[model samples]
Target: ERGLLCALALSREQFVTPGHALVLRLVRLSAEATAPHVEPALLAQKPLLDRHGNAPVYVAQNLLEQLAARFEFSASDDEFQAYRKCLRPRSLDENAPRPLVGRAIELLQFKAVIEATQECQDGHVVYVRGMAGIGKTRLVSEFLEM
Candidate 1:
């Protein structure tokens, strides 16, 4: 609370100094640090509760909400909307990569090798090496989606 009071009392110019800057940061951090708010009804629902409990899930949700509320992307509504769109989750179909085009065969081979190796009793390393833009990354990504 004293930090907050000190931060409020300091002028913008005072904030430029290292000592004042530290005070301002500490106040900002204290302001942003909040406990998660979970409903009693939600807590009562066993299926709704994560095995680890609600704190972690609600903490993340509250943090994201706080961030979204605080975020300022200019006064333009379009800019704010654009920023909000980026925060939304895409549908699975939307997330799926475009027809992996020329890498289909390699993708299939990679998937096959991965599946075959899963039964191995010993640990093994699978390395994908290729020049840039040759779709080595694309192949791995496509394989992961499988």
Candidate 2:
């Protein structure tokens, strides 16, 4: 909660530093400052990926390496995908749509008009249609309520 408050305190206009990488290389010559023998040996080892094309492994590795060096996280592809999914937002809740049948009936009105004109009956099977929010659905609801 405190962290959230602190984050909320930050202004959207604030400028933030992205990331900075620092590489360190140490050389030792036979338990001491090594000449340059290690450089050739290290270069001789073939890279994990061939030079044909950027493989998924290399791409994922590069992404993970960048994320690790920047965010201090070295996650696998599945983990990264899961984390990315977390960043995505689900659409608005559809379980309960707005303007419920009763509420829509209230809005559509005309139910009173229908009741006044036609006698109410069970299974009336009233069908209302309109362009956009013209209240056809609401009309049906109002009639149903009556």
Candidate 3:
């Protein structure tokens, strides 16, 4: 978080800038540091960087080494197609409903879903059904935000 914040401030660009290599090195070091506590399954699931030319690994290592020598980290991809998959920004569908404010009444439906799940012995799906202009999506979005 600290390094990203530093990069964000330093770059001052509108879009995501390069410095991702630093994040990878930091996560790698953190995972190694916390290896004992983390499950093998979790580490196995993590994406690994092979020796490739997407982004230079040596540059990342040098930056990490330089930064590590200066200050401690107190706070905190693949090929072209793979990189796109990894770095793609979450885009909302054109018809996706936007969240509506001042919708406290919608929370009752959320609570009902929660209560139903608690009482059920078997797993069940709580489908939010409603017609157009109704606030079903908005209600669910609010519930998730909460």
Query: Which candidate wins on TM-score?
Result: 1
- TM-score of decoy 1: 0.31
lDDT of 3 at 21: 32
Clashing residue pairs in candidate 3 (N, C-alpha, C atoms within 3 angstroms): none
lDDT per residue for candidate 3 within 1-146, as digits (tens), equals 24534543433442322322322223345544654423222332344464232321111333444444333332212222111111221344757654455677668766776778889854667677889977776677778887
lDDT of each: 0.40, 0.33, 0.43
What would the C-alpha RMSD of candidate 1 be, to one decimal place? Answer: 20.2
- For residue 57, give model 2's deviation from the true position in Å: 38
Models ranked on TM-score: 1, 3, 2
Candidate 2 residue spans exceeding 4 A from truth: 1-90, 100-109, 118-127, 132-135, 142-146
Rank order by lDDT, top first? 3, 1, 2
Q: Which candidate's lDDT is highest? A: 3
Count of steric clashes across candidates, in order? 0, 4, 0
Runs in model 3 deviating more than 4 A are: 1-102, 119-121
